[model samples]
Target: MKMFWVLTLAGILVAGMGSRDGAVAQTRVPQKVMKYLESHSFQDLVRRYGNTTIELSVPSREARYLDSLPYRLEAGFRVQVVATTDKQNASNIYRQVKQLQLDSTYLVQEQGLFKVQVGNFTVRDSARKLLDQLYYAGFKDAWIAPATIHIAKKAKVLPTPSDSIYFAIQVMATHSRSKAEETAQTIRKKWNLPVRILAEGNLFKVLAGNFSEESMARQQLQYLREHGWPDAWLTQLLPN
Candidate 1:
């Protein structure tokens, strides 16, 4: 009788396991097992058996695949709306853009300048379209800037000596070391552009960017003027 009951119970459990929907089987449990379970509450059984914890394990194939992937860079074009020495102004402009439902707006501090920039575009044409939208929406100073945008970590690349022979925009100069650092920090934070402070005798000269050509520097100078650095001047950086 016990052997016969075991065969019947196995058949019922097999039917239950086969169903995708997992509806309870109409097959009834063996009377003896059902009676034993009915006498013991689920909580009581769990307390008696104690508990075990489980952690998910990664497959070796998946772990190796993830390790083999190469590091990728995500540098691209962006539309800069405004930059200012005042933090409050940057905050206000950022809020204004957000209110206009311009979702990609960002406020960054560089040297001493706080800038509100928008969008991650892979091409100049895409950034230009956003620039037109911003201008039409009353942000007349908006312009596109090509930059190295890091999604994960910044890429490490060694520059050749010849790379220093480029134009730069000198936005400010002062005798105070603190003042030079503050301004340079703001510019770097806002634009991700290179900023340098040269000790020109007593004065500390704060300069930004190393454009490969004079025209490129002039273009950036105009952009800086429209975006709040009106006194910006272009200077060539001779390779040392």
Candidate 2:
């Protein structure tokens, strides 16, 4: 009986191998025969387990942050300070900062290096004025230093004759001639208002502001009058 069973298993294994990839796959598999043939391989196994594959993908790397830096441009200037040969200059600056209420402070740059900075103002002209004033006020070492100003990214507000009084200043003419020059300088110096002078024929008309409301213009004019510039007045600059 053992010999008969052994012969039957061997016959099933041979039949399975022959019919693995053919129409004669109707071969009956006994449990022992199936286990014996399970470890064998065929063309499908060769295509799956022996096949090499390469994937197309992006390589892993540390992310770059260079593009995230700001493109905001700052017009730069430098400020000169007392060069500390010893502790004296730094001490003088520290003392004067308290005495004068200056909006600047000291920066410890490195070993044996210290910097006195005045302001981080948005206006370049203001910085220049501060430098000049400091120098003229006996701080000869005062000068401007080129520093990057982090200006907020925004759509630039342009200089135009804007009126809030429901009417715009319509200048029939403009010129940089002598009377026009005088009027501009006078307005800026006296009333803290920028002057724009216009010429129609031989007449030199100086207009100080653009306002949407006549009441606002009157208020500004009143302020100018209080400052003793009585000649300041308002009129419709709009062309008829």
Candidate 3:
């Protein structure tokens, strides 16, 4: 009777594993096992299994990948359009700045105020030019401010297999490497998706996801725009 019961249980397990819909399979699983599976992701399962059963020969690959990211900082200047304790006012000023179609713009929260700044310039004269433009544009209080900025480096685009293409959502771009990385981390933690920082010209772009379909990227872009990153937009990644 015990052997017969074991054979019947084996058959049930096999049937559950072969089901097309996971609902039927999950129904057959024990409550405890089902709960465990529900709580853990597929990546977690693979990581746990691999750590216990496999030996990684090259753990330094992870360190090398991190080291490949360029991180350089230097003294710079920025045109500060507005510094206000009122969040709504600061946001309104940011939109006004965007309307002027400046190259780079970002909001910095420092010392209990939101500062809307634009143009990452290596020299004060360049920043002063933007400040004058802001003044003429009705931002009379705009001034040049000294800031530490990220020195952008050319990003190496790795060739994709079979010349395949992908898309991503650019949530933010800034002259501060720390700010870009921080934003990337926040997005990753919130959405549980891959985030990358790419240097282009004089800015660090924070991009999220590697979606194969443009529709999927557009969906994610809409979601991000509705969320905290109101300026997020879709970008295509082509094979080199």
Candidate 4:
């Protein structure tokens, strides 16, 4: 029911955004998610409630409910795993990634040292993609783990840019539009996230995902990295 209202509101926004005379009115846009949504149209969706909503041009089926937040089902057949060396010298890597504010974590420690594992991608292809990124980063030992599949919802308490997705490669802090655009191009083609340039004052952010879930964003990150963007990381954009 809420999803219906949200979709209805989105349609109204797109159809009623402006006039040549410069009328001023405000309707809520998922501020963080707006950039990606700009690349898509509500009419583009093939409505899940009926045959009316436009489907995202991707290959997944609609969930049983709206917002689909309560039931994020996996869309592919294979699961992916990202493996790196045992955490003997991973402290520096961890610190660097942490400083950048990415969710760098390791599995429960076992054996002689800690092993950094980024994810268990629901799709084998998605996992393999990240494996390639790890290999190029000089960690040739990464592989996929396909056995942990489950139909579950990743409860995201915060609504991220609840629109479309765009991933831009970026520096921690700076506004070099050209650099950001170049990075966006790489990811737009690679991950199909429709990358764009977002400038917040002087901090140039490489954003992705009007995406609703962290898992999907992470997969998109993996996809971008595999396609020659080794420097890309997840950029969280909160909802309005």
Question: Every model's Cα RMSD, please?
Answer: 17.9, 23.5, 18.2, 18.9
Q: On residues 16-111, what C-alpha lDDT tens digit does candidate 4 reach at each position?
A: 233324443455556665775566656563242223322233223443343454434344322122334555456655553344333324443445
Cα RMSD of predicted structure 4: 18.9
lDDT of 1 by residue, 89-142 (tens): 899999999787642467888889998888655566656766888999999988
Ranking by lDDT: 3, 1, 2, 4
Q: Which stretches of candidate 3 lie over 4 Å from their true place?
A: 1-71, 157-240
lDDT of 3: 0.67
TM-score of each: 0.34, 0.29, 0.38, 0.33
By the TM-score metric, which is better: model 1 or model 3?
3
Model 1 weakest lDDT span, ten residues long: 1-10
* Candidate 2: worst-modelled 10 consecutive residues by lDDT: 1-10
- Candidate 4, residue 212: how far the Cα is off, in Å: 0.6
- The candidate scoring highest on TM-score is 3
lDDT of each: 0.64, 0.48, 0.67, 0.46
Ranking by TM-score: 3, 1, 4, 2
